[model samples]
Target: MNKLIEREKITFHKVKPDPSSLEFGKYFTDYMFVMDYEEGMGWYHPRIAPYAPLTLDPSASVFHYGQAVFEGLKAYRTEDGRVLLFRPDQNIKRLNRSCERMSMPPLDEVLVLEALTQLVELEKDWVPKEKGTSLYIRPFVIATEPSLGVKASKSYTFMIVLSPVGSYYGDDQLKPVRIYVEDEYVRAVNGGVGNAKTSGNYAASLQAQRKANDLGYDQVLWLDAIEKKYVEEVGSMNIFFVINGEAVTPALSGSILSGITRASAIELIRSWGIPVREERISIDEIYTASARGELTEVFGTGTAAVVTPVGELNIHGKTVIVGDGQIGGISKKLYESITDIQLGKVKGPVNWTVEV
Candidate 1:
């Protein structure tokens, strides 16, 4: 029987890179998935083809109006040769939600799921079996219509590309990182497209990120736009602080992203009898907790970095060290548990991992 998604394999596969020395998003796989959408025609022509460059018109809306959204998820290769995807449905649904926020047409969840499975299945060999490596799948949508007007584009292109990669923090670079608290530049406001996984949100953050780098910090910890005091996110990931045996994370305000890994960590921490609270958190409060010796651990959760511990914080001119500049117990446990669940060593929540 013919599958719903069309497939076209490449004539010759490129020489695979060394899996042990893979760079993040540096190397791409042999195949890619693509689909198109029009105002009246909806989405059609779902197909998988050989990896190639895209040709777009000069006045594409994505280049002008910036109507682009993307989602990131990984495919893990089990020790027994099976492949698994962690919370892919959540990423797909979040992609649609991002599309809605960006004035783009929604994607069919069923079609996308099918296409992802088929594409990953075909490129199973590209899934690295390294200890801390996996296949990074990037599904993105861009406005392709060549229009100069500042309006929503009539046509859009959705594409999924696969990259076999190592850790986002580099090879064997899973230790704690220094974060600089940013207050001068803001990432997003409440009414802005902050909650959406759009490209502009990231582009707007580059300035602060660069500032943090110049200040000798690994990443920037963005505060709320309005007050510039409340904690928002640390670099591109959601942040968590352990205070007096409680896991405190910034609430899912309109500006903060609802990270799937953050949610899973919260649930797992709660299951371990640790209280997890999602509310508006302030950097000042964190500093106070640290001064009082209540701050236990600080970490970040996201798709790329997974779970990253923060060892030191640069708050204005004061320097704050987190738990003796080392990975905390909670951070270690969450990282191990999540990776185990992803690799099929232990079962997680129902429907968490979709085997491809």
Candidate 2:
């Protein structure tokens, strides 16, 4: 059966006219893409219309059971006035990974790509061309079935929304920031849904992050669930460390998110002859490297921030500092190359940029 779509024009909240003044995820674009799914009928009701409120029953399964998944990406405008999407296929694949863990139906890749492309085109005016700014795209799925049962819902809703966002880190280049070690809580456990981009994973990390922030740290560095010693991630981003002139990061232990930006950085850096290794890294190793003056750099990668430098790491009542509290040589190069590809300053891998 064909999907049914109905369009509606709604009023948008007026804001400051300039995109440069906009904060991250504050101002939204004018339109959105929505669709609904049912058990027997499958997904239908695709629509591209004005952004508005979604009416849901108080007992909706998503409200109670927390069966929700989301993906974060961006639509960037290049120097030549052409809008493009950076690695959207990776986002679609990751979204499906989240759906499987959350017990939601897997979305069709082609359909999703089309929906996103059309939505980006609809909001092309919202894509900021200010070098570090772009239109942030959020695609999410929720269990909308009005039942309190603990099982997966028979009905769901999928939506894509856009927000014109500015630079995430700040105006200046990324400075090595501080992070607090989390010993009391674990972000993910073995054989759990930690690798999935689900809401619960993020929700579990909030308290630890709050404590880190209170300690004047920029983020929380999570550890393994059992030992609480193996360095896992830095909140929403994947982590990397430099030791002995080689780039190393924790292996995917099924408890850490495989960020798209993380993969891109690995590829870009390795192409430049940097030795990038994925292995299990422990807190002891990080501190020891810093103590020996062998730790070259530490950074986190994600969609929002792109790449962030970690200058000081606080763990188990000890403070470890890396390289004069400044961005390392490799970190700077990776940031520049990735931004160049994203902003269309340099040539990219084949089909890396999807023109809208």
Candidate 3:
């Protein structure tokens, strides 16, 4: 443990449930975990208390500077009635990486794990029983020092909140979504905080997503900021394509978040006897492959939706349908395997799931 938590701070709130109309991230659990840090004084007084509003001064650095980072992961209830977290260590490591980029202090990984485990234990009933539903755990850090200077804040707060989220899509799995390739607006850039899970990265993408939706597209597929031809990612998920019997994705390239699900999928593909490559993939290559009938599938991978297939991609006034306008062979198998492992139907590599 980082430091023993103050048991007195623990509190719970009871509420009625409405299953008919559950929206993602709308409701939260009764209790949350919090820890504070100051300039010379180190982190102190870890507490698990009732979820409530945070009061910050009008001139807080975060208000003006936007120094905030967050991570999202899920805890599932196995068929045998046990709670488990999938690859939690990876999330903490990613959190530390984001902290470094945002100039926020990093907590001990062991401490974070312990704190999160305790939080889940306190709110075990909140973990949904439905197969496709689970407790969405969000751990975030924000600068809290009261100053208007354009610099990192000296004081900070780390908190964890839980949300019971169902499938991001409705009743049936989503139809293959149409994505718009935007060359006018960019999401991230090289030598920037693109690789970090910072709030600004997502806030920057919202406007483009709104524009795409207005244009009858499901989401925006952002391109490289410099050349605007290299494919980066789709919405918040990592993008993948199957071409010429191979699975290909754009390399990390210092400008994209390396998703945990993305890394897992690549390893799973390798085990399935498919070659996976991470290299620069230009939009021209995608168009060329589709035109030559070599493009088989396209999909996006993330924790929220797990895996979603993309049927149509619109690039610069040209619309291309992938593989007869339906999900491809590899896409179906990958989805089944990954979902099976998450729900405990199939065995996976060691350390993939941690018992709750």
The TM-score leader among the candidates is 1
Judge candidate 3 at residue 171 and give its lDDT. Answer: 66
What C-alpha lDDT, on a 0 to 100 scale, does residue 337 get in candidate 2? 87
lDDT of 3 at 184: 94
lDDT of 2 by residue, 1-356 (tens): 12444566666644534876877787777889999999999998888878878999999999899999999999889999988899999999999989998899999888899889988987788888886888999999999999987899999999999998888876854967898989998899978989988888888888989989888998999999999889999987899999999999988989889989999988988899889999999999988888899998999999998899988989897988878888999988888888888887887898788889
In model 3, the runs with Cα more than 4 Å from the true position are 1-3, 8-12
Per residue, candidate 3 scores C-alpha lDDT tens digits across 1-356 of 43486544434366725644557888898888899989889787788888888999999877889989999999887888778888889999999999998899888898889989888987888887775788899999999999888888999999999988887775655458889999999999999999999999999999999999999999899999999999999997999999999999999998999999999899999999999999999999999999999999999999888888899999998999987778778878888888778777788899888777
Q: Which ten residues in a row are the worst by lDDT in model 1?
A: 1-10
- The TM-score of candidate 2 is 0.96
| Local distance difference test, each candidate | 0.93, 0.88, 0.88
Instruction: Give the best candidate by lDDT.
Output: 1
Error of model 2, residue 187, in angstroms: 0.3
Models ranked on lDDT: 1, 2, 3
Give TM-scores for every candidate, taking all chains together and pairing residue i with residue i. Answer: 0.99, 0.96, 0.96
Model 1, residue 134: C-alpha shift (Å): 0.2
**Model 1 residue 68 lDDT score:** 100
